[model samples]
Target: MEFFNNHTKLFITAFLLFAGLTLLVCIIPALNNQSNNAPLPMAVPLSDMAIKGKGVFIANGCVGCHTQQVRNVDMDKVWGERPSIAADYADIHRTDFWRNTATLMGTERTGPDLTSIGTRQPSKEWQLPHLFNPRILIKESIMPAYPWMFEIKDKAQPGDVVVNIPEEYLGGRKGKVIAKAEALELLAYLQSLKQTKLPSASPQPAFLYGKVGEESDAKPGATKELNGGMLYTNNCQSCHQQNGEGLKGAFPPLKGSKVVTAEDPELLVNIIMNGYTGREKEGYPAMPPIGTNNRLKAEEISAIMNHERTSWGNSAKKVTVDEVKKLMEKVKVKAK
Candidate 1:
C-alpha cells in the first residue's frame, strides 16, 4: 500500500503502462506494415526537388481537394492504369519526426484524382500556367490559383523559367510571369506522382462491379471498345464542357466552330495530338496535348474526333481509324 501511494512510483508506472499500450496498438503494427509491404519493382524514390515540392503541396492544402488514390471501380479507370495497391503506398513515410503525413489517399475529391496526372498531362508548359491560374485554361475550373508561387519580372533573366500565361490572365500587369523555385519544385512533385508498372507475369487486379467486359476480350457480337461519349467525358469534357459550348474568352466554343465542322480533319487531329497555341495571341490559353500525352490509340483518337465533329449541333464528316492512325504515325515521327 505504501509503495502504491508513493507519488513518483505511481506516476512512472502509469506512464509506462500508457506507453506500452501505445507501442502495442500503434507502433508495432505500423512497423509490421512497413516491413511487410515493399514498393513495386519499377518504383523509384522521389527526387530531392520532388520532396520539397511535396512539402509545398501539403502546405497549400492540395490534399483537401485532390485525391491520390484510384479506387477499384470502372469510374476510377480514368485516373489510373489500375487500382491502387498497398505496395503503391509502401514507400510513403512520415513528413518528419514531428509530423506523420500518411499516404495522401484523401477522402473527398473536390478535384480530380492525381494518381496518374504525370502521365495524363505531362507538359510543364500546361501545368505551370494552370497552377498560376486554372481558369486561364479551363474557365469552369473551381481550383484556386497559386500566384504566390510565381514572380512577375520586367525582363526574364538568363536562367529564369518564364511562364507564358495568356496576357489577359495577368490582371493587366506589365511583366512576364516567371516560375519561382517553389512552383518548379511543386511541378516536379506533381510530375513524380506516376503509377509504376506492375510485373508482367503478375495478374492485375480486376476492378470489381464494373462493366464485366470493359477490358476483357470482346464478345462475338458486343463492342467492348470504349465509345466516343466515354472518351470525351474522360478527356475533353473538362475543358470543352458537356454541351461543347466552351466558355467565352477562354476556350473557343466547339459548338459551331469551323474547325469542328470542317470537312478536313487534319487541323483538328493535330490540335488533339500535339496541342493548340495558335490562338494564344487572341488571349485563349494553349490547349494541352491530350492524345499524345494520354497515349490514346488510333481507334480512341478517331472516336474522340468523331464525337467532337458531330456533337453540339455541328454536323461534320466522321474520321476513320486508319486515317487518324496514319496521321498519328506522322505526328509521332515528327515529334522525334
Candidate 2:
C-alpha cells in the first residue's frame, strides 16, 4: 500500500518497462533486419567527396524539392529505369548518433525525381551552370540559386574550376565565376545518384497501370518515328530558348546560325555527334556531347537536327535517319 503512493518509484518502474519493450520489440529486430539486408551487387559505395557532398545536399534542403525514390508506377518510369527496391537503400548508414536521416527518400516532389539523374543528365557543364543559377539554364525555373557556392575572381588561379556565368547574372561583378569546393562536392553527390541495376535472375517490379499492348515489335536497328519538338524541349530547350534565340554571351543562337543553315549538313551532324569546342574561344562554354551521352538513336538525332533546321525562321534540308546513322558509325570509328 505504501509502494503505490511512491510516485518517483512508480515512474521509474514504468520507464524501465517501456525501455525494455522498446529494446526487445523494436531495436533488436531492426538491428537483425539491417544485418540481413545487404546492398545490391551493382551498388557503388559513395566516394569520400560524395559523402561530404551528401552532407551539403542535406544542408541545402534539396530533399524538400527533389525526391530520391522512384515509385512503382507508369508515370515514375521516366525517373528511373526500374522501380526502387529495399536493397537499393540497404547500405545507407546513419548520419550521426543524433540524426537518423539515413534514407533520403523524400516525399512530395516539388522538382523532378533524382533517382537516376546521374544517368539522365550526367553533363557537368550543364549541372554546374544549373546550380549557379537555374534561370541561366531554365528561364522559368522557380528554384532559387546558390551563388554562395561559387566565387568571382579577376583571374583563375591554378587548379581553379571556372564556371561560365551569363553576363547579366554576374550582378555587374567583373571576373570569372569559380565553383567553390561546396558546389563541386554538391555536384559530385548529384552525379552519384545512379540507380543500381538488378541481377538477371532477380527481375525488378514492372511499372503498374501502363497502357496495355503498347509494347513495340520493331527490329533493334529499324528506323522509328521520334518527336523532334518534344526531344528539343527535353534536351536543348534549356540552353536554347523555345524561340531559338540563345542567351547572348552564353549559349550561341541557332536562329540564324550558319552551321544550322549550311548546305553541307556533315559539319552540323559532326558537331551534334561530337560536341563543339570552337565556340568556347568565343566566351561561350563548350557544348556537352549530348548525342553520345544520351545514346540517341539515328531517328532521334535526325528529328532534333530537322527541328532545329526548319523552325525559328531557318529553312534547311531535312536530314534522314540513314544519313545520321551512317554518320554516327563513321564518327564512332573516327574517334577510335
Candidate 3:
C-alpha cells in the first residue's frame, strides 16, 4: 500500500505493467504467428531505381493520400483479387538504417488503394499525365499535380520519353512535356506496389457477408442482358471518359471512332486482347490491354464492344460472345 501511494513507485509499476502487457498481447503473439514463419511468396527487394523513387514518393507526401493495404472486406474486392495477408508485407524492410521511412502502409485513403496498382494500372501513359495533372485524366480528381517532376522541351531528343498532354489542359504552355528521371523513378516505385499472392493451398477469400445467396435471385433459363454501362465503368472508364469521349491527344475518343463502329470487329478485338500503340504517331499513348490485365471473359468483351459501338449516338452492330471468342482464338494462334 505504501509503495502504491508513492509517485515514483507507482510510475515504475505502471510502466512495467504496460510493457508486460504489450509483450504478451502484441510481441509474443506476433512471434508465435505461423505467418511470420512462412517465407515471402512474391516479395522482392526494391531495385535501385525503385528505392530512389520510394524516396520521391515519401518526399512528396504521397502517403497522405494513398493506402497500401487492402482490408478483408467485400468492398475492397475491386482493388485486389484477394485479401492481404501477413506474408504480403513480411519481406518489407526499412529504406535505410538512418531513416525509419520503411513500409508506407498508409492509414488514410484519400486516393485509391495501391496494393495491386502495378497490375491494375500498369500503363506508363496514364500514370505520367496523371502525375503531372490529375484533372487532365480525371476531371473530378482532387489530386495535386507534381509538375516539378517533368520538364518542357521544344523537341524531344533520342532516348527521351515524351508525355502526351492534351492541348486544352496544357494551360497555354508550349513545347512537349517530358517526365524527368525523378518522375520515372517514382513510376517504377508505384509499379512495384503490388501485393504478393498467397499460396494456392491456403487462400483467404474476401469477406462478402451480404452477397451470400444473392446469385439465386436470377431466374433459371432467363438470360439477363449484360449492363454495358456498368461494365465500362468498372473496366474502361478510368482511361476513357464516361461519355466515351476519351482525353484528346492522350486517349483517342471512342464516341465517333471508326474502330468502335467498324463492320469487322477483328481490329478492335485484337487491340483489346493484345493492346495497341500504332496511334502514337497521332499523339495517342499506347493503350494497355485491359482485357488481358483484368482477365476479362469473351462475354465481358462482347458487352464492352457492344457498349462502345452503340453508345454516344453510334449504332453499330452488337458483338456476340461467340464472335469475341473466335477472335481471341485467332489472336492466340497468331501468337503461336
- The lDDT leader among the candidates is 2
Where is model 1 more than 4 Å wrong at Cα?
Answer: 1-14, 211-233, 237-303, 311-315, 320-336
TM values, all candidates: 0.73, 0.76, 0.82
**lDDT of candidate 3 over 1-336, digit per residue (tens):** 899789999999899999999999998897787454664665777898989999999999999999888787877766777777766766666667898786687999999988888878877888999999988778789999999999999999898889988877677989989999999999999888776766678756655644676547678965456788888888888789888998766778899899989999999988887888889899776777678766678978899999999999889999888889999999867756
What is the lDDT for 145 in model 1? 95
- For model 2 the local lDDT of residue 223 reads 56
lDDT of 1 at 281: 87
Q: Report the lDDT tens digits of candidate 2 across residue range 1-336.
A: 777799999889999999999999999999898888899988999999989999999999999999999899888876877889888899999999999988889987988889888877665777888999998888888898999999999999999988877788988999989999999998999899998888889876898988775437667766567889998887778887788998776688999999988887877777777777887788776776677655567888899999999999999999898888888888877767
Each prediction's Cα lDDT score? Answer: 0.84, 0.85, 0.83
Best by the TM-score measure: 3
- Go through the candidates in order and give the C-alpha RMSD of each one to the true structure: 5.5, 4.9, 3.4
Candidate 2: minimum summed lDDT over ten consecutive residues — where? 213-222
**Model 2 residue pairs with clashes:** none
Count the clashes in each prediction: 0, 0, 0
